[model samples]
Target: MLNYRNALRVGTASCLEETSVDVSYEDGSPDDDDVPRRAIVAVLPPDQETRILMLTTYLNLARCASHVGRNKDAVVCATLAAGIAQHDEHTDHLITAKILRSRAHLAQNHLKQALRDSAAATELAPSDHKSVQLLARDVERAKRAALRANKQLAKEVSTWVQSAQSKFAEQGGNEADCAQQ
Candidate 1:
């Protein structure tokens, strides 16, 4: 009884839901950064290929954004994670996405956004849980640091702008003078 579009959507959704991740930490420390989630996802059945792929893809994209200092790229990865959760329904992925989304917000100094996402991740996370709890704590700490960072940058930029305005005023609002000094 499903319409063509609805069927396609459902099928695609299920297809994507098959993907997953590895969440194990070695001695409470991640053994590898490249595919930190590998250990967790690897334990799942071979039939869950999509879940594995999605998890890896999201993690890689997030790492890439960090390496490149690209907040937009990070946001895109987070968005993909949010989408994956629609069909995946696994608690882990949802928590991971929330953490990733929080990272994106933190990178851009969006404190409120970061706080909300990180808090969600921490709350929904399992007790005696895996990766989610640690990431949530990390993000929460980072959120506080980000707030300070934003305020510091705002102060610096404001000071610079104010100094420039004062210097320009001394020169009778001369554009050329402002540009020179």
Candidate 2:
């Protein structure tokens, strides 16, 4: 049988397999944010109660990080908490982790990822939970923010394309005149 430390190591390794963003949009590299994967829970033991306590700590850390505008840090903390709270007995912690993660993603403007986490939390929590209602409102705010960002990006792209086309036409006209001469 594996030693307790070895089992904890293996468990931590397995938990790192989860994707950073569940609903990816354009192709992109994995988020190698500053938070080291193992460092987040390196001292975790195999005990269930300790794990639950650590989950609470991480969730609190995530909330504080988000409040300070450190969204990437918040995401990392919440993700680690979620990984630790995977057992049936830790359902409430898992829900809190998902909600915190969703908020972090929303702060970072990752609309799809935020929605995915929010949905997971909603599914896990009772329909009448106060946090679930708050999450619904957060989702609405995220949708509006995403729409505004999309509109801004579209305008920027259109302007860039127009400028590029005009420059190309100017170069083509100059080349034609040079050929005639």
Highest lDDT, which number? 2
Error of 2 at 122 (Å): 1.0
Q: Write the per-residue lDDT of candidate 2 for residues 1-181, one digit (tens) a residue.
A: 0112222211322323343212211113232332234333444567877877887898899999999999989987887787677642578888998999899998888888889999999998999989977987888887997799889999999898678667766877554554465
Give a tens-digit lDDT track for model 1, residues 79-125: 55554553456667767777777777877877787778877877888
Candidate 1 minimal-lDDT segment of 10 residues: 1-10
Taking every candidate in turn, the Cα RMSD to the unseen true structure, in Å, is 13.5, 9.9
Top candidate on TM-score is 2
| lDDT of candidate model 1 versus the reference | 0.60
Per-model TM values vs. the true structure: 0.47, 0.62
